[model samples]
Target: MTGSTVGSATAARGLRWLGRWLLRAKCWLALLLLTAVTVWWLSQELILVAVVVAVGVSPGLVGATWVAASPRSFERLAAGPWRRLRWRRVITSRWEAVCRDAHLAERRRVERRSLTGERMITESWRCPRLARVRTTSHAMELIIRARSGQTVTELEAGAERIGSIFDAVAVRCWPVSGSTVAIELIMRDVLITPTIGTEPDGLVVDTVRLGRTQAGRDWLLPITGRHTLCVGASGSGKGSVLWGICCGLAPAVHADLVRLWGVDLKAGVELATGRHLFSAFARTADEAVRVLATLAEVTEQRGQAMAGRTRQHRPAPSDPLHVLVIDELAALTAYAPAEVKKEADRLLARILTQGRALGVVVVAFVQDPRKEIVGMRGLFTQTVALRLRSGEETSMVLGDGMAKLAPAHRISPATPGVGWLVEDTGSTDRVRADYWSDDQIRQVATRFRTGVQAVLITPTEPVDRQRERSRRVRTPKAGAA
Candidate 1:
């Protein structure tokens, strides 16, 4: 049995090699024949004919070698036409029916004032014009012009209806204009179930790529001069966002331009997995209070140092940027003992309100983003709301009236990493957090771990004591006087 298995495997490999060699040979032969014919017709000089043939055959040989080197690229190029054919068929066959069933056609009656001020009633009939349907490797986009008197809110609200009509994995709506909406139908749920690739590279001190949007745009979080809050339900992929930020800043961490401080009150279950990447991490409420205190002290020291000297703080190795990442913020804010909670709140408020300009940032994750839970929610300049339990929860995390439009509460559990990001500009985007598995985190942590740990200056330090001692030493020359 072993011999037979080995024989079959050898045969398959040999066949593959022979087939590749034959393809290269065929290309060479065809190019040689064409070159020979052209040379024969162009000139009778044997030397000129030889030169032309040599140049032509050389190009064919190079081309064949490159083609053999990367077979996957050639296979993808070959399959492009068939993929487009199927995409066109899907669009032509089902678009109209799906739109109609999703209630995109206006069928009701509405009243309008006439030019002469007489009221007139007319059929409120206007169908959504199917402008274009484009298909890509990841998703299909349906651009439609909303009919008269229709708004993007109505179209966005109908996203699930349209998704159900077409049996898509999910649907997202982007309002291109007042009367134009671009609906995206995700054919497959690839965002939540990504195959691990090369570890994500890090960014400069102040930027972090949270993840990519459903349309494949990088969703960057500018942690410079801004605070961020991430809220999601359990198992909704909030951890992915945390690790995404870590991976995006790993290079800076290694360079000592960034110092990461973590407060994982869950006994270090979620964040301790990447223990090597953090400069300082706290696993208990008392330790968390101390961590925040150190950050608050750092913020104060920088503020005094920059007082009246500079308007904005610049990051440097002398004062590396400090980022305090807290998992389950409610544990520190609402669930801790009264003493620890009070101090934690004060330290956190100090950091959020005054730390950004000093290069001290915070990225806090919570399962619920109620004001009662994180009372200083307004202090955060950026917020990302993932899958939630209710519309009110979404609204609370994002803002009022966002629940109906973005509808984060309605996000499917199967698409775990999907969420909505609200920046300081008040613009909202639907994004998916990158899936970072345990193995990927370990690999990145091991690669970027530095031996140097960050040093924090407290309010009381030996430098001040040294200054006082120098003053005394200079004054004690009474004998010489």
Candidate 2:
């Protein structure tokens, strides 16, 4: 009985070695080398005693230093052939359990391994289905591939979904490849996106809630980055989206850090409304240009100052600043001279590219982002598609190819505010835009009514906030007066 027991133990040990070698060969090799070195050092006795002690204490000391540490224990498994067979059996057994006793199902003929290097190409058929929620569409893709092994695969794992340019998708590389693998999956019908916010209720607006309501798992807003473009026809809710963003910006801006430069060509004071805080509002195209130029100057100065700072060592701005909100850009564009427009575009370009680090943010709203308005090459990469008055206008703001949405989402004169947003992130999600009454705008601006900055007012305001700068200028220097 003792000899039999010894033989069983020896077999078990051999199997363990085999499993380790086949599954974790690199780890086992390092473990064996370490064991050999320790054994050799121990043989040195008193001469290497300190070295042995040092080695023995190192792991414990390092582990105690940081609570979140990687474990070195898993590196010590032994290796060999029989262990691989044992592990294979364990895996096979578990896999078989899921299929056992049901039906013989799809049993395959047992065969020897015959694969060398192999590759597979896959394709998926897409179908449009009504979205499960309030979204536009729920997309589904069915994919099939050619391969040789009887392995498991996941739906999203073997598919590639590229967004940004919509109504069409190009298949990039699939995540997984195998022979005879087939899968059917439904892709979500997406949108241009709606501005998002958290409501007191736990319910999330729009189509995708993921698994919960509220911002919960559904909040797709990315915290980093600067710049966004909003466009749509009259009543598409482009104004509504801007309103929600302004509402969100209120708490952020009132935190009393950054500056908001608003340019509204409609000559409306709707957006300038707000609390007792730091802010600036521009009513004309020339005024908008001046404000944007000031931002460019700040950007150049900051970049020069931070040239020596590394990413980890970099410091935030002395103030919290982000999210520029410009309403009715088309109107402003109409008034600026071609040269001034070019200069303003250049400054806006810089803001979109480098403003994130310096705490500068931009959220520009235009009725139609036709290639003509922002230029084919412009700063508005992140766009929100609101309702459009014409199919051509929708195509212009959303890309000529997106013309399909024209007949589908066109806006009427009464929409006032409503549309979808395409955030700075590449995803083209759509949501319902929020809004504010004309009264809300006036209320918000009451506090900022203090007046304009001297630099801004010199060219645009009838009077500057600092009475001394303008009060004395118009009065003529003391000698002139």
Candidate 3:
């Protein structure tokens, strides 16, 4: 309140305001200074000509320099930063309007009394604040601080409109904190290019490299103590996921650290090609049931063996991890006879529930994800949802309301193997499995054969011979005729 104190405080406030103003106007000040220098230099014709030539050749010179130097350094130090700054400016310029258009802006009516003691009514709009913007090679991430009355649901509902306005291929929003949300705008389709399956370095039993995530990170599927259920429509690259896991496990199988059992209920049309890789292969309904029962029994025995000894099962040559891969799970769970279906469901339920800690894991692939068909779907810890028929199916596979976040239903049919991976913690990521051709499968299987031939339980008689016998029994003898 003293005169000198007030003067000092006023001066401090003035200095702070001037600093902020200068910071805001720095770019324009730089441009003005550059223009003034250019005008002064252009008074000389030679200097003007040199400036023009330099402007014309600078791009090529920079390009050559980048090529000569480290390209990655240039990208990280120069190009990436510039792109991020430019996108930040662009997004900031349109943030308010975008929020208003998307219905994320809250409006309120304010009543106040002015200095004249008169009542005044005013309307105000509150838009969500853009906290930060980060850019990658193929995507933009926007971190938003929600306004007082805003909810994450409102933000999620407006994601599509935001993506369309920003010319993004897709948009996903997730809550980062109680009042903050992160939105990812996918600018390009990174998963469009299919990649071939690659063998892992050694016996990697915990997680296997499947393919690349949408962010171009390695997509590793955890198989050691996880039961994975992959649900996709027919021709939606279910085979790619199946073979990707098998290929990654090839080394482990060869080293006797992992054992693979295949149950292809499509009459061996799928698993027969890679039979050498499996310790036991089942094709018919009866065979598949027996295989499930056997695995279930093994799981029980392992659980009893490791009950008090150890809490977790460790993979070794003597006690290897058992991976049972079932193709077309609906065949045994839904479409089989009553006896087979009941027995298979019971056995699968037991295995899926108890096998995770016992070193017995099941990777089942199915087209239908209906609860009635795969009632034990909830038991699987990891769910991979490929191109599905509807949002309903996506929710069924990945839990409720995940369709909006992951949107496996929106995956294009042209891009097989592209799907959403839902982990047990309720986080979702978009991933693509590496494609494995028949030739590649055969090659990998041959190179890493377990040398433990499967016990194939085929029919007793050939179909043609059985048909001939039936025909002769129905027909009269030649002499009687």
Candidate 4:
């Protein structure tokens, strides 16, 4: 029995190794055959045809063979060039068909004699010029220059029509320059499924992997010098984003290297599942306001302490990093009572403007992101918009120009956790937040419960009321009658 098990294991390993080698050898084999054919054609004394073909295919052949031993490396190296070559053919064929079918092609002019005996011909219309083709990791970008009499607006309006002809997942168009336009057809959907990853150790101070981009790149959110705002409708996966942040910071919470204050105005039901992971938690409007005021005071104290000695603050247990996570921000900012709303606004504004320098940051989630509703929206530089109702709302969360580029509104309802992240640099990427099962959340909360040294802040109550509650708790109940 032992010999049989060993033989089976050995056979599996051999098959995997063989598969890897074959994947590498296929690209090399194609290059070798092309090289041999070019040499044969050149040896047959066909000068012009052989010269043109050899010059085009030889450089690629050399590069592929150099990386032939590593299958993954070869795939990465070949992907860009192969896509560029393939897209050129696809564009030339499909674009012409589209132009003809749509009656967008220019007609040739013929000379005609006028009644006054002078020959005249009308000017012919010009076709859109293909400026260049750029291949990204998962999509192809076409840069086009408009003709003399044509406008980029016409091309932008027809982007969807062209996309339908190409069978693309999504089509995006924008002006690159005054006279040029860029049309990108995303051929792949990297975020169609929920990506699974383990909880972060939180030893690293400022980095966390939130999800992945449409290009299969890790979307790392940096919290040291930034604040994040996530906007998504109900059932649009806001919970996933919130818990992803907590899970990534759980280890730091356990170590006391970081402190968390949670304000879930939804009666603490959303964040209560991971209650053990936070230092202080607030459920009501009053409690949330109190927590914000305390955080603002702490920021002020930290700033005063750093005034004389240092200009920058470093995070540690003595003066740990502070993170304020608020779910349903509109309840505090827009829907609270008049007095509580005013106080909440005053305290939150103070924290948002002056907290980053003192190692204090906020991550807030909201359903509506209108400027009037979230008056302090300008303070958050990192914004994530997920599955919004319309393009207007998408622009409200991600910015005006991002509505068409990122297309958060077009996100299918079937895909809940997928969203687009807009950076401070005005670049946009589609990200799918990691989903945590109930069991996984419980496991993380139990494994990384806050320690004894953690300080918790709550709204102060009257001494008599607290004594009465304690007496009631200590009083024993009578036997059943």
TM-score top scorer: 3
Q: RMSD, each candidate, Å?
A: 13.8, 21.9, 14.7, 11.9
Q: How does each model score on lDDT? A: 0.78, 0.46, 0.83, 0.78
Cα distance off (Å), candidate 3, residue 30: 22
How does candidate 2 score on lDDT? 0.46
Ranking by TM-score: 3, 1, 4, 2
Question: Residue 83 lDDT in model 4?
Answer: 65
User: What is the TM-score (0 to 1) of candidate 4?
Assistant: 0.63
Per-residue alpha-carbon lDDT of candidate 2 for residues 106-185, written as tens digits (9 for 90 to 100)? 44444344466455444432222111211112322223332223232332232332122122222112322343222212
Which regions of candidate 1 deviate over 4 angstroms? 1-75, 78-134, 142-168, 175-182, 210-212, 216-219, 304-314, 401-432, 437-439, 456-481
**Regions of model 4 farther than 4 Å from truth:** 1-137, 140-185, 452-481
Error of 4 at 230 (Å): 0.9
Instruction: Pick the winner on lDDT between candidates 2 and 4.
Output: 4
What is candidate 1's lDDT per residue for 1-481, written digit by digit as tens?
Answer: 6988866765665456546655757877687678777777777677877777777556444434444455456436643445656766876787656666777776778899999999988874456777888876556788888777877878777777887766776577767888888878766555655433247554476677767766556777787777889899998988888998887788888887788899999999999899999988889988888788788888888999999998677777666788899999999999999988887888899899999888899999999888889899999888889899999999888889988767889888888778987645344667887788899888888988855665643323336679998899878676785
| Residue 219 in candidate 3, Cα distance off native in Å | 2.3
Give stretches of model 3 more than 4 Å off. Answer: 1-82, 92-131, 148-161, 390-392, 400-407, 423-428, 451-481
Top lDDT hit: 3
Across residues 408-439, which tens digit of lDDT does each residue of candidate 4 receive?
88888888779987655445667888888777
168-247 in candidate 3: lDDT tens per residue? 87666677887887888877778999998875667788899889888767898899889999999988999999998988
